[model samples]
Target chain A: MRESRSDRIFYMVNNIFLFIILIIVLYPMIYIVSCSFSNPRSVTSGAVWLWPVEPTLLGYKTIFENKDILTGYTNSAYYTICGTTLAVILTVLAAYPLSRKDYALRNPIMLIFTFTMFFGGGLIPTYLLMSNLGLINTRAVMIIPGALSVYNVIVTRTYFQSTIPIELLEASQIDGCSDFTFFRKVALPLSKAIIAVIALFYAVGYWNSYFSALIYLHDREKYPLQLFLREILIQNTIDAEALSKGQMSIEDMAARQSLFELLKYSLIIVASIPVLCIYPFIQKYFVKGVMIGSLKG
Target chain B: MPDNKTYFYIKKWIDKNWQLTLMVILPLSFIILFHYVPMYGIQIAFKNYRAVDGIWGSKWVGFDHFIKFFKSYQFIRVTRNTIMLSLYSLIAGFPVPIILAIALNCCKNIKFKKTVQLVTYAPHFISVVVLMGMVIQILSPKYGLLNNLIKALGGEEVLFMAEGRYFRSIYVWSGIWQNMGFSAIIYISALSSVDPTLHEAAIVDGASRLKRVFYIDIPCIVPTIVILLILNLGSIMNVGFEKVLLLQNPTNTEYSEVISTLIYKQGLASAMPQYSYSTAIGIFNSLVNFFLIVGVNTIARKLGETSLW
Candidate 1:
């Protein structure tokens, strides 16, 4: 088919519009990276725009040296790994049985699970309950209270129902396979993709979460990276507040302030490094997970 | 004889499916412990809750807490803030992904399209703390990127984060920037499922790409759009609480103190936590959210076939 002149104009306009959006999205990411690497003085002066100006590793070096930051990083890593594993297991435990057509109480059990999605006990009650259970100010508080998400359960169940055939179950049963054996050997192995997706979801949630920590944790030792980040980045406390009280000379204060500014840019990059590193490998799985979830919707 | 027969049948069924029951037992226990138990504890909202007295032992205060909350000055401020922010987000953030998806769909250059998708989606994975950190850095008055840009352009520097008026735009637009690509994935998938033969047919009939988008693409994805819109409306009461809390400062608290943040403050962050009063506020928020979702779902069912249930 021959293209018309107007169609050419439309294509040109559409491409330009999308290109502008692309820049809008990409510029901040590029600027932050550039600023993180640039000399603190250059960054504070806004000389580092699209590229690094007088590049140095001082920002990253400072972040790595900070004891609080290191402790928080370790805590976040622990929570994410432990929490994700438990979440995935619990989600599968709920989702798989509910997926089975012959499960006697599937519908009622599903209703019980889904009801939580609509309403909850809210903050105070939940907090009180947590305190009563002796989970407050503990590492278990982060992992246990939020182990199973009903949304992920539904998504996994939908995946199991569609992908794992009932015929396979019946055939295995005739071969004298028990339900537990079938689940262990067949259902789990067959549902690895959905499991990966669910695990990723939980891992990200655990890694990014701070509200749980804020409410439950009191000891600074238990603080996650995000909580530490809250102090440094958002609250602008710690060194800045401490420095003011010590009566630093003008030049020294200005120099420390510039380094603080540069530190934030580097902190953002370092904090995001784990997710960004794993993202490329799992991006396809994340897309697949969303697609599976949308099918139920 | 009938009772005995039913018992025998139940025993046989249990024997056959006990393994399945075993699989669900732990998770079921988790739900009951974590979810339903807190719900039962909600009764403390009507009681004068004390740590010594416990939830059940506390003396009942009837409607006192509710009444106090209803009469409080913070009530209107928080509710208004919550609604305005959510509505602003919905109005501004909703259509952006659809536009992005459609634009991407129309682009024939696969490499450019893939690059756009990749870069745009990257920000969504950044922790909320990090994202907010970036926002504060970019909007800082002295030596910040935006202020620097303003200075370079011969405009006076502005404290973007400090001012209450700039809060909503900054929050909503940043949210859009972070989420638009990730949210567009669903619509992009929906667009992919569009029958290419329809586009072919439209083109053969002298329909241009833009015309095909309006006449075919939009219509095909309307159901997806409607479903998502219904879902969005259902959660209108929930302004992104964490982000609001992060963005909030002394100057902006008047505009930024939504119900969730208020609940956090009243319950946990205060010098003397008002457990009962905070619980009352929470219950009120939950009820509003519940009704909004149910009401939206019902309206969707009545108006279209895309109701959540």
Candidate 2:
């Protein structure tokens, strides 16, 4: 049937509205990329608008030369890798047993895990516990306390229950395959998609975390990239207050200030690149994870 | 005779399922150590905890810390700020994603829809620190994008971050920008599962696209919407602690201080940490959150079919 004029008008208007939203979302991202490439002076002078003005690599060069940023990058990488690995392993170990129908204590155990999601010991007690255990200001502070997530366990358990058949477990058991062998040889291999989803969730979480470090860590060398970014991007705004105190020459101040402005843009892009790079490849898995979670698990 | 029989049954169950028992041991220990241990340590809230005396040895000061928190001047400010910010975010941020999901569902062009989805979802992955960095850059009075636009339009530049009044709007809107796309995914999937025949039947009945969305699409997704709304209501006290802390400065502290940040400052960041008092404040916050979730869940169960439990 040929479309009515009113229906056509509706489609046209809807598309335009969506297009405006598209611009609203894309503009900041594009402007950030453009500002990162623009010359420091041009960036500070507001000459760069939608694209690079007198493009240069000085911002990235300055970032690369900063020792603190490099140390932070290495520390963040170490934390992400170790934390994700531990979290995935622990989540799977918890989820699989809870998924089994024959597991005698699944209900109470699951309740034990779920209760923590809504209520916790709060900050002071957790901190005191961490300190009492001698984890303060150590590398273990980054990984150990946050190894298992109850939400991920529930999601992964739901995946296992829906996708993995109990008949297969019964058959394997009849053939003398123990539960350990079945989990190692059969369940893990078949559940790669859910595993990938859980791993990505944990990896992104570990990469973006800074609060634990802020509260627990006192050493600069142990700081994550986010802590460093906080210092540079947010705390550095205080330097303007210092500038009014006349701590440096005017010319030197202006030059240093411009460089810091450009560096902020570059750092935002550089810091987000790791997650953004892998996002497209794993986007479907994330959608699947969310869908599985939304189900009444 | 009954005790012996019960013991025998327990032994047989453990023997038969010992592998499952072994699988849970490590994770169970982790939960006990990390989660349950801290809960046991919550007794510090009632004690005048000293490093030398330790948690157990400290003198009991029952309800003193909680009373102090209630009577303190900072209490009202932080509580009001927390509730206002959370309510503002919920009221403003909740509807955008539902509208976006509905709009995306209405569009028939596959390529345009896919592009919109991809670009919108990109910001959700950006970390909070970087997001605040971007916000600061865009809102800077000197040499910032908004400032530049204002100057070009013959308007005066405003210090967006420094001012107290702009804090809630900035926090809520930036949150909506970052999360709207990702949050819409669940609703999008819910819409996709909607029966096409419903729309076809509506079309046959002379319904417009807008009318079809109202009559068929929305009613089909109401359960999903209700479940999500319940979850959001349950988390009203959370208020995105890290982002708020990152955005807070001495100038904006009056508007920006929330319970979680206050807890951090008093317990960890202060020169002389007030461990017991901070713990008391934390307990109060958690109790409110717990009651809020339970109360909301109860209401939801009574009024609707979907409840978290």
Candidate 3:
């Protein structure tokens, strides 16, 4: 309970340490942003300042000039929007039915869903199932298989059960409101916080998805921006022998490698900025949602 | 009562709605088909699988793949590296968010706190591929900021990505950097729910910030810590394979060949497609994870506290 002089010094030092951590966290992102706006030569030569040295829009220009990059962005935007809408709608529908206390089958149905959170058939079965469903390579593949997340359903159902008081529902029933009417007017209106959080989660999941597209999507035309950026960054960092027994000449290889290295950091910023800009509004809700969802049953 | 009649009427209505029934039916099928069905293929580890012959037709070869894996030269190295890296991440990465949340809680400067939270949370949404690319750019021996900093500090440059010894440290620490802030948000939310009256009382008693954090803040969140730790332990086998796969080269393969990557190489990356072998390895991995979760849950139950059940 006592604050000695050393304790005061410790508190000051801790604040300073927290400040240093803040810088460590922010520096990479700031560096990437700066490099994206810098001239290519400055970026390639690693002579760019913490702020852009030349302050040019050339990097952005170069990225936009590539037709594949533009298509990739469009495809990613398309999938994220379509996918999040379907996912959220399906999740709410499924969760609402399961949240009913008097639903005779609620316990078994909930168990069936919860069982999946622990176990799975791993990747192979999932892949086979997708193919058999004839969903492979279609835009539908991006949305359908992931249309309902069990975890998201549980969170929504919990929110409905715990936060939406039974007394409110009873009052609505006394007012002669139908089940759908109560859900549409009262429940959904009260659920904006959880909905916002879940929507962000689903949006981020859809946006940052590369692994699913890697397996299910065969056509490059359908690749998301993350996959496009992935190929540019990691795919280009391969050994020559590993590629095709030295097809590339020394000079060409060197030039290609240089572009790959220079573009890597810039690409991170380009891919991340849209999602990053939206974070501040959703930031407060994310923690509350995750804690309530995670720490509770 | 009218309530009893209403309840019966609602139940009757639900029974007749086939469309609603199909909602449960369709999604339930997805889980069963995708998640439960392939569990049958786990037996392939004890069999010699033939694609044309199928799972039933595959010849039983009891313990053969397991023996082969155990005796294989890469086995000990991969297992040891995987366990060690996971354990290290658990030790170092788990508590970072807890500490960070506490630090954020102690800060009275709301502006400074929010700025720090925003900065820290940014890295989480950055994909593993991009994060690794950033890591390589910043740790490259020739031009990296870290190496340059070391040079400025009168130390030799370290090839962080190339050296096996440094690989786990880089992986774990970078992991902490990416996730600690995002993970802390939950704990911070939990901290907020702690009765402010407790903090006020401690302040009146002249409790130092460190004392308040250690005695009051941490204890308030111990249940959260325990639940998260148990869940974490449940999925220890799932090391983030994509990051490791992206970062690894032949030079660093010794330290980088975790289970998922191993499954990937066997399944899709081999000279010959060994789907059966990969499936076997994957099954082995899942079984271990299953046992680990069950074991921890049992212990939690025995300890007379929260269990997943």
For this target, which candidate reaches the highest TM-score against the unseen true structure? Answer: 1
- How well does candidate 2 score on lDDT at residue A276? 92
Give TM-score values for chain A, per-prediction.
0.93, 0.91, 0.87
Q: Candidates sorted by lDDT, descending order?
A: 1, 2, 3
Model 1 chain A: worst 10 consecutive residues (lDDT sum): A241-250
Q: What is the lDDT of candidate 3?
A: 0.77
lDDT of 3 by residue, B109-167 (tens): 78888899888987888777778778887888866667767877899989887787788
Tell me how each candidate scores on DockQ against the true complex: 0.73, 0.70, 0.42
Of the pair 2 and 3, which is ahead by DockQ? Answer: 2
Interface RMSD of 2: 1.4
Query: What is candidate 2's lDDT per residue for A1-297, written digit by digit as tens?
Result: 878888899899989988988999999999999999988889989998899999887778777767777888999999999999999999999999999988888888888888889989989889989998999999999988888998899999998888889999999989999889999999999888888888988888889999999988999999999999998888874234333333224467687788788888988888999999998898878778777765546
Q: Kindly report which residue pairs in candidate 3 clash with one another.
A: none
Per-residue lDDT for B1-309 in model 2, tens only? Answer: 469988999899987778876887789889888888999878989999999998899999999999999999999999999999999999999999999999999898989998998888889988999999999999999989999999999999999999988998999999999999989988998998898999889999999888888999999999989888888898888889999998898788889999999999999889999999999999999999999999999999999888887
Candidate 2 Cα errors over 4 Å, as ranges = A237-251, B1-8
Query: What are the candidates' interface root-mean-square deviations?
Result: 1.3, 1.4, 2.8
In order, what lDDT does every prediction score? 0.90, 0.89, 0.77
lDDT of 2 at B45: 94
Q: B194, model 1: CA deviation in Å?
A: 2.0
Clashing pairs in 1: none
